[model samples]
Each structure stands twice: as structure tokens, then as C-alpha cells.
Target chain A: MKKQWYDYLWILSLTYLILGFFNIMFAWLGLICFFVPLLISLIKGTKGYCNRYCGRGQLFGLLGGTFGLSRKKDIPKWMKSKWFRYGFLIFFFAMFFLMLWNTYLVFAGARDLKEVVTLLWTFKVPWHWAYHGTLIHPGAAQFAFGFYSVMLTSTVLGLITMVLFKPRSWCVYCPMGTMTQIICKIKDKK
Target chain B: MSSIRKKRKAFVEQADCVACGCCVKVCPLGAIRIISGIMAQVDMEKCVGCGKCAKECPASVIAVKEVTA
Candidate 1:
């Protein structure tokens, strides 16, 4: 059980969250997390990103396995079913687009810049402390707020599932994992 | 080029398996399953021995081994 370089990647997940808290601009870095999985799955035709490079998944594994925070129960069968996985993927994208729409509103000057991060799309946590009024378009900052919310919300969900079930149980229904898996399947067919 | 070629299949060292289900998600053929939250069981019939699981496994308890048909 020797640790590889990738094994320590969980630190990146934590660091991203922390950096985003102090400065919302750091949220743009999440685009790397967003796109790299799809790019790897497309080019390599494997779940290589989710399997080895996902910092969030590794964070859950570290918390649930190394720290023994997990109850070690099996995720329910329904969670692994194709129907639930696909449904979740769809829902996740809808929320993502909605976040973008909000950002667009700010960009278009139709809405005021929301100086808060919405957690799980419900509770809005005032985040003005993170933004000191950048000279850049407020829309960019708005996107960072929204994107950080998405990242944080997913991480919280992963942690919850990790404590309630298997350490990496969130991987069963992760939207990125589902998208990459679909990409892998399509590429393997060619 | 022997007539009988060696085939590799995933074998889980059950005693050491953390049953994290990383292998189950990465198996392209859906060949691995966690048995009641305990350990990963590989379905040799479905597994292609891609070693994706072996490499993805954090515990490193899964080994791809050559098996005779």
C-alpha cells in the first residue's frame, strides 16, 4: 500500500476550497477540475481521471478511510442503478446552467452582483468578505461565487455519503464520473 | 506465440480490501462488485484484466493475475 504522487492529491481539494474562501477569484481554477476529467476520459477512453486523479474523491477516501470517519455501510442498490445516476447527472447540469444564467444576469447588468455564495442552491451565505471589490466585471466575480458554491456543495455531499456509507460512495453517482463513463463507453465503441 | 495464451483477471485480496468501490466504478465491463460492503468480488467472466481497478485501488489489494482457461 505504498502511496503514489496522486495519493496526496486530496490536499489540492482542501487547498482549493480554502483559497476560494479567501479570494473568490481562485474559483476559476475549478475549471481545470471541471474539464480535465472529460478531456482525460475522451482522449484516454478510460475513467482514469475519476479513478486516479480526482482530488475530491481522494479527499473523501482520506476522510472516510484513513481517518475512519465512515460507518462503512454499503450504498443502497438504487444509488448505483442507471436510472438514478442518469437522473442525477441531468439535475446537476440543470443546476450548473442555472448558475451560469445567474452570472449572465449580472453580466448583462440586469441583476445586482450577489455578494454571497449559495450552498446547495438554497442557503445563501454572505461572502462579501471574500470580495474586496475587484476592478474586473462583477460577472466574473459572480461566476466565481456560483462555481465555488457548486464545488463546495458537491464536496459536502461526498463527505456526507462517505460518513453514511462507503468512503468513495459518492463516486457511484458523481455527475463528472457519469459523464466521463459515458465518454469512455462511447470512445471504446469506436 | 503459444497456442494457449495466458489471460489476466482481477483478484481481490479480500482480507485486505477496504471495499471502497473504486474498482467497481472504473471497471468498463462492470465486472467488479462489493459483496455486502465487505470486499470486492471480481467476475472473471466479465473482467478483461485491463488492470484499471488494480491501478485505481487505493489500498492496492487488487492484483491482476494470469489465469489458465
Candidate 2:
């Protein structure tokens, strides 16, 4: 295969530039796109976006593929222990609940976009560096809070997953991946 | 035609593969193919160690290594 510097750049640019911008504005839609590729990867057994598409993945893939830095050998048995997997599941659901509660707050008019943003920034959390929107406004704070909650939940889950499950565990248990796996199983059975 | 024997470098562990097709889809040289009865294979001659296949294989079954030219 022809490995070009441009391919790596394109993946980074699309992920950080296009996806990052859309995620800040159309949060739900952005989540869908972000998670869908992960789900597709899990069910299909491919890194999907991470291998060729994700900005983060591109960075890592380039380092590993070019410099031989991040290439994995064997996933240690302790890392893949049942306790870790189950613990991840618990954390995943808990985060999901938190996300739901945050969403409820938004719909119930208990919060707004600005409030969410401030809460996130106050917590020293940065969702996407480029499009932070307004920092001090109430609506922006609310938006940040809601946005950051999702980001935190996913980030924590992703970190644990990678450390424990071969650097792609989030792709397997992702709600999007869960849904797709279910669908794929059903299709296989049929 | 230059006659030089190319070293074999394609390593696939079927037992570990989840058959995600990321290798097949991302292979810039179209070297990897998934046979739907449920296994995947790599065409050694076509593979150039771009590492796209190995990078995308979620199961980590595909590994690319450098061999003598």
C-alpha cells in the first residue's frame, strides 16, 4: 500500500476540523457520527475510524506504523480480566445515567447552553480546543456542562477501555457499538 | 522482468480475527480480502506493509513486519 503523508493529514484535518466543529454545534449529530464508526469497528472487527479516519487514531497509527512506537504485542491477561470488563460496564452505565440526567436538565429548562459550557471549563475540562464558543455566557455554560458531561463520560470510558482491552474496548461497549452488534447478530441469525 | 524472491511477511491469525473488513477496505494496495464464510486473507505480493491493514484490524490478528528485500 502506498503510505502518503497526505493521507495522514487528511484524516487529522477531517476529524479535528470538520467533526470537531460540527460536534460543538450539533452535539447529538456529532455524537452519532463519532460513535457510529466505533460501533461499526466493533461489529466488523476493524478499527474503522480509528485506523484511517479518527484524528486521534491517525496520530497514534502514524506513530506506531511509521515509528513503531504504539504497536501492541499481547494484551495482558490481567488487563483483560473479567473484573475490569465488568467494572467498565458498570462505569459505562453510570455515565449513561449521568448523561440522561444532564439531558433531562436541559429539556426541563433547568439549564441552558452557557451554563453547561462554564461548568465544563470550570472543571478544567476542554472538549474541543478550536470551537469553544462563548466562555462566560450562561447559555454557553449550560451547553458546556451537557457537552462536557458526554465528553467526560466517553473519555473516561475510552481511557479505561484502551488500558484494559487492547486499545479498542470503547468500540465494543459503546452504546452505538452495542446497538450495531445487536443488529449484526440478528442479521447473522437470519 | 527482475527475478528476486520476495520474503513472505503476511501473518494472519484466524483464531484472533473478528473479520471487521477494515483491512480489506483500507488496504491501499487492495491486498487483503475477507472470505465471507468468515475468514480473512492477505495477498502477500500486493501487500506493501503500509500497516493500514494491521492498524485497522481490531482483533490485532494482522501484523506487518519488515523482511529482507
Candidate 3:
């Protein structure tokens, strides 16, 4: 079936990004927005939410493919390997756990959210230095971490894949996409 | 003379699919999906009869019939 206008889901990220920069609690709404649809896709045994309705996926298509030109080439062979996808999954979980730990520290009063937000570590690059942003909206640090992790990663992935391959190529190896594919398969047994 | 007719749309042999997901990348219409992570099944509704997936399939499992119904 042809994709409809509403199928574009990535456009919604603008809201999430703005929310995260302002109020933290509201930004978490983005998580709930996505996880819920993904949960449903598992039960439905179809990537309806992803293929037909994901905002971020739609954004990639709109910005990278529809309005712009994509290379329409194939991704690197290593990118399609199970090792690369699983390795990314592991790295994502590690960062997720660390985000959780940071949140725990704030809630436990051991290091407060304020300190965590203000905390800075600079890494000098050959040309310059890079530092984590100083200001995070007022909300759960976990939510901030989750939001940034997703937005930055998606943006980077969308940009790279759009250039190297097609706009939707990132979907092939997306950690969550892979996880849902696994889940839907497990849910259907002979 | 009947052989002159165009080939029908492609279909999966099921037993031959390796579920490598290579075809999924090449398909512009997103007509193919790995069902249960085991078999790559084609969505007839979404497939516009384009054979990009079949062309990209490494296993040679997807084939179109020379004769049409």
C-alpha cells in the first residue's frame, strides 16, 4: 500500500527535542509515545507502527529521500551482520544502564541532578574540544538521557544511512527495530 | 507462443530463504519482511510487482512464473 501523509513519524521528534530542552518530565512523553506503538507492533506480528506510522522513520524519508536525494546504495556488509547489530544492542544497553545509574544517584541525594547537569568533561580533539551540553531540561535525568540518546543517534544514523544507502537503511540495523523483529517472531510459534 | 507472455510476480519458496535481510534493503517499496525472523515473506498488497527483492536475493529462492494466470 502507498504510504499516507500521517505515516511520517519523525516529524514528531521536533516536539520531543524542544520538550527535552525545556521541561524534562514532558520530554519523557516521547518515550511513552514510541514504546507504546512498538509494544503494539509486537502483538500484531507486523511492523505496522514502524513501516506505516513511525514519525522518525517518516522524517528520514521526508528530509532525506522525498525532498532530497539519497545515494540508494547498499550499506557496508559489516553493517548487516548480526555481530554489528548485536554489538550495537549491547552498547545501547550499557549506556541505558549508565543513564539509569546517573538518575539513581540524583534521586538518592548522593550527587543531585544539578551537579550532574553542571558536570563537564572535556576531550580535546585534534582541531578542538568537545563537551557534553551543560543545560538539560528540568526532569528526570534518565529521561533526558533517553531522549538525547535516541534523537542524536537517530539523527546520526539517518544522516549516514541516507548518504551511504537509502533513507530507510537505518531501519535494517536499528537496535529497537531489531528487538521488535525478534519479539514479533517469538510471539508467533508453530 | 504462450511463453511470450510476461512473467508473473515473484514468490518465495520459503525453504530457500536464509532471512539475511539483504533484499529488504534493496526493496524500494518495503514489500518484503522477515517473518518470525525465519522466513522473508512478501506482502502481496505492498508489492507493486517490482522484482528488486528477487534480483537482490542471494539464495535464488524468489522466482516469477514464466506463465501468467
Query: A187 in model 1: Cα distance from truth in Å?
Result: 1.1
Error of 1 at B31 (Å): 12
For candidate 3 chain A, the 10 contiguous residues with the lowest summed lDDT are: A119-128
Please state how well chain A of candidate 3 matches the true chain A, as a TM-score.
0.76
Residue-level lDDT for B51 in candidate 3 = 78
lDDT of 2 at B21: 50
**Candidate 1 deviant stretches above 4 angstroms:** B1-21, B24-69
TM-score of chain A of each: 0.97, 0.51, 0.76
lDDT tens digits, residues A18-134, model 1? 998799999999999889987877777666676567888888877887799988776676776778878999999999999999999999999999988888879999998899777
Put down candidate 3 lDDT per residue, A42-105, tens digits, no spaces: 6676555554456666666666566665666655667766777778777766766776676777
CAPRI quality of model 2: incorrect
Going through the candidates in order, what fraction of the true interface contacts does each contain?
0.02, 0.07, 0.10
Please report how far candidate 3 places residue A105 from its true position, in Å: 1.0
Return whichever of 1 and 2 wins on lDDT. Answer: 1
Report, for every candidate in turn, its global Cα lDDT versus the true structure: 0.81, 0.51, 0.59
Which candidate gets the maximum lDDT versus the true structure? 1
Lowest-sum lDDT 10-residue window in model 1 chain A: A43-52
lDDT of 2: 0.51
Between prediction 2 and prediction 3, the one with superior DockQ is 3
